[model samples]
Target: MKTLPAQLTPFVRSDVTGALLAETLGRPEEEFSLAELGRRIGAGGGVVHKEVGRLLESGVLVDRQSGRNRLVRANQGHPLYSLMRELIQATYGPVPVLRDLLGGLDGVERAYIYGSWAARRHGEPGEYPNDVDVLVVGDPPRRELADLAVRAGEQVGLDVNITRVGRDEWDAASPSPFIATVRSRPLVEVLTEASDG
Candidate 1:
């Protein structure tokens, strides 16, 4: 999301645009209101509205008004639909992909993408991350977590590293250098137990 339109891939106009396509194009069957899109991406509603407007005008997305809400979904008939989906999956796929991969798991109190990938996603100017770093807080089975990491990495076409920490060790009160370093950087929340409920 931090990559400017020019710095971002040629297809995307902005961070919001990338996120919008990732949500709509990545899940073509689902429709999302502007507010929901903003919330999911941790972006402002105005930014999401603007991006949706651009996409609608360009026929990348189609929307219908439902009361006061604007419900939008991907336009499968658009000629570039396939290309857009592919680009979005590679660039903006982490959030939604990780969300899906972690949603059903038990003992996952919180999960996030950290390190350089997160820095880029959070708007910091940095080299494109060579791999994705994930921080999982809780005691999920290591085997299950590792398996899901492989699946996620395949979908995004990048190496995904999962680092596990117990809830108590991840706490700020604890004297863990790893937790402190992660806390000090840009982090993207993938999923949380509260988000599920």
Candidate 2:
């Protein structure tokens, strides 16, 4: 198992989050069963079901039931989804531009393209992503990363936001049923490699 850094000890465990997302990605058409979701995340089926219910209430996810089974899906049409895209596209898009430029010190580990892009890429294509919402793990230099993002915004119209938080922070927040649901799905559409030094 890969270990998150000490500073990121405050974030939620990406394992469960990633597992749930991977399962969702695998099943493009089927609504995930509580048992299936639990099996994927290595937790009790009941626990997964409860979490899914919580997600539904948070407006981060939506679900429909078929008999005893419940199908859950991310609510991409939500306003925040558009807001996230705008922020990213308005910030970064150019290939050789400043904001389009990623520096070495940005503490970006693995990045996942979640939200609208992911929904469109996996399910049905809707509006093109305005900005890209990337879930960045690891702590890169904040100022440099912000500078690059700002420059990219100025050059290209891509609103690219580097949502880089520590693992510990993630862990701390996930305990909340609301946050856990919000993060129930993927973060962006394209999982790109950070720029080379």
Candidate 3:
């Protein structure tokens, strides 16, 4: 089977590591309590506790006690911080970032990433993808989504393309040629109503 990006190998080897990297490294400026981190990553409290201890010992993360809770954050001062940040962004940033950016928009039912980046993630050999192509299935306000896409593109260092479609159009038995093409391509689903459930 095709594997995750090589740079993410270490983190993906375990769910805990992957969640920690995705939740903490992706936002180095933010600190998370164990409970909050566990909730965000869908991990059990015990697993997060053990993994956080290991990470703290390895200097990949730093923690400080606040009253009864321990708050943890990525160790920005660590020598490998920058490289880890870049790899985290390359491997796990796009989907979550786009999900957060677009998931709350009114009428958005689902979102997917298609084209080059999706192919690359599926282990297709090629040059690195430089842009993110997002397909939004819903009737969200076009201007607002476009504006959010611009901001997200800047944050992720990629040109973001947002394509909107209505629910009826997306569920049609006979889709348009453009929709057919998208359906035939490799897709990385970022958000869906079912996912939340």
**Best candidate per lDDT, number?**
1
Cα-lDDT of candidate 3: 0.78
Ten contiguous residues minimizing lDDT sum, candidate 3: 1-10
lDDT, candidate 3, 1-40, per-residue tens: 2224432334354535665776799888999999988766
Which digits, one per residue and each the tens of the lDDT, describe model 2 over residues 54-153? Answer: 6567674677878977778656666664543333223222222321244344555544555564443333336655765555545777776677666655
Error of 1 at 162 (Å): 1.0
lDDT of 1 at 41: 78
Q: Over 4 Å off in model 3, which ranges?
A: 1-20, 29-58, 62-72
Positional deviation of residue 136's Cα in model 1 after best superposition, in angstroms: 0.7
Across residues 75-163, which tens digit of lDDT does each residue of candidate 1 receive?
99999898888878878888899888888888888999998887777677767788889999999999999999999999988899999
Ranking by lDDT: 1, 3, 2
What is the full ranking by TM-score, best candidate first? 1, 3, 2
Clashing pairs for predicted structure model 3, backbone only: none
TM-score of each: 0.90, 0.38, 0.72
List lDDT for all candidates, in order: 0.84, 0.48, 0.78
Tell me the TM-score of model 2.
0.38
